[model samples]
Target chain A: MHELSIAQSVVEAVEKELESQPGALLRKIGLRIGELSGVDPDSLRFSWECLTRETGFEGVALVIETRAWQRRCPPCDIVFAVSDYQTVCPQCGTRETEHAGGNELDIAYLELETP
Target chain B: MTQIPMERKVLGENDRIAAALREEFHRRGIFCLNLISSPGAGKTLLLEKTLEGFAPDRRVAVLTGDIQTDNDARRLARYGFPVQQITTAGACHLDARMIERHLANWDLSTIGLLLIENVGNLVCPTSYDLGEDAKVVILSVAEGDDKPLKYPGIFHRAELLVLSKIDLLPYVPFDIAAARDNARKVNPAIEIVELSSTTGAGLDAWRAWLDRRAVH
Candidate 1:
């Protein structure tokens, strides 16, 4: 699975973001993953564990929040959650609804302690 | 522990690299496309057919990736154009870094169309952007019609869905209508092109689709 690669990238990004703060103890990291982002949260956590084992980043916890697929209809001016993979706007039967999200993968927050 | 509200993208490094590649492509007037599919979904064959149709002087090149062999590159290079193979070792997908590395030696200014055949796993490839103008996902009739529904990630992200090996539709249990419908259910705006690299059927439409997108 590519989750290992993803986990490595995420860890690297966090490490880079924390580089300026000397002796910053990164205690936890929060992730917001979309359903259609092609990342499995559980698998990512496992990968994170494998990457952090015995490293200086050991014992760092991971928090994940998942987002569902969404669609927004311009004419109806309504945002709707997608169900059963249906993207059509429920309000106006609009077929041109834009994909609002369901593919965003971001780091929501980082819990750390400065030594 | 203090919780700092980061709201940063985890794959920001990859995104930054892809953004740079996109800028370089745009600056060089290059039209790039990333082709993704499951293993044995006729990606290499489709590229073979596509490369065959190009004129000898056409400023088009290909970069094909696989977990191990250079066989795909060998196959595509038979058309007398520049084709390179990226062996990812065990990686299931090709990230922007792999693409940037392989493209280091190429004269991008002379290239107008650059086609990248990603490592053949639909799921992982969908997550990595290669700075292409569009993503094209290919599925063959040999695979189930429910493939699009099963792997909605790539289907939703791709701009065009190329339905390959359509000539085998009569021999197989694959339903073309159902496949198209499932793809549309996930992505209403995804374009579909049905073709067979073997019998040369529907290749014109595929070529035309490329022609329309390969703006100089």
Candidate 2:
């Protein structure tokens, strides 16, 4: 699954971040996955477990925050949450809405133990 | 016990490599396209037809990604254009690092157009950018008109939507207008092209579009 790759990316990012703080053990990883980011969080966590197994980071917590997809109506200038790819403005009934948010895949923060 | 705010992108490594690739492509004046679709969407056939149409006048090369076999690469190699296949083994999509590794030995200056046929999966490929000028999503008539809405992420990221297998429209239940409308709802600026590689229908327009964007 693509989640494996994403998990690997997360591991790499954490490893890079740890380079600055030597001997600090990773305790938790925080991620912000958007609805439209095409990532499955459950799968990511599973992959992360498999990847970190036997490593010092085993049992580390992965906290994922899911963001909802939002779109802005060009005519009505209304920003509304979208469940699907529904671009039709609920207020003005126009189909000229543009994407506003919910495409992010960021590693927000990390919790570490001072060794 | 201390929380540090990194605020870094998870795919930062891939994105950074992709940006470098994009800069290299721009410097070389090579127009690159990433073609994405589901399996059995006739991506190889369309590429074959495209190479046949663009070759002899333009320098074209291809990198096709798949989970197992390099059959698509073999099929495209018949067109006499340079072709390479990246077998993901079991991976569902192609990432920028894969492309960067594959292009390590290749010469980019001789190529005017480079078309990358991503591993056929609608969802996974959407998030991975391959340093292309455009991401073209291919939807066949056989796949139904509701695919854009069903897999909105790919449609939302694509710059062009190619409706392939128009020759089968008579037998299939696909509604082209509805597909276009759905795609537009997700991405209003996405360009649509209808073509059938089997019947040679709309190939000229596709070629024209390629020619206009391709650096030749």
Candidate with best DockQ: 1
Return the lDDT, model 1, position B140: 97
The reply for model 2, stretches above 4 Å from the true place, is A73-78, A89-96
TM-score of every candidate: 0.98, 0.94
Interface RMSD of each: 1.0, 1.5
The DockQ assigned to candidate 1 is 0.84
- Off-target runs (Cα >4 Å) in candidate 1 are none
lDDT for residue B121 in candidate 1, whole number 0-100: 92
Q: Each model's DockQ?
A: 0.84, 0.73
Candidate 2 chain B has its poorest 10 consecutive residues by lDDT at B51-60
lDDT by residue (A24-103, candidate 1, tens digit) is 78999999999899999999999999998999788888989999999999999988989998899888887899999899
Compute the lDDT of residue B114 as modeled in candidate 1: 94
lDDT of 2 by residue, A22-45 (tens): 978788999999888989899999
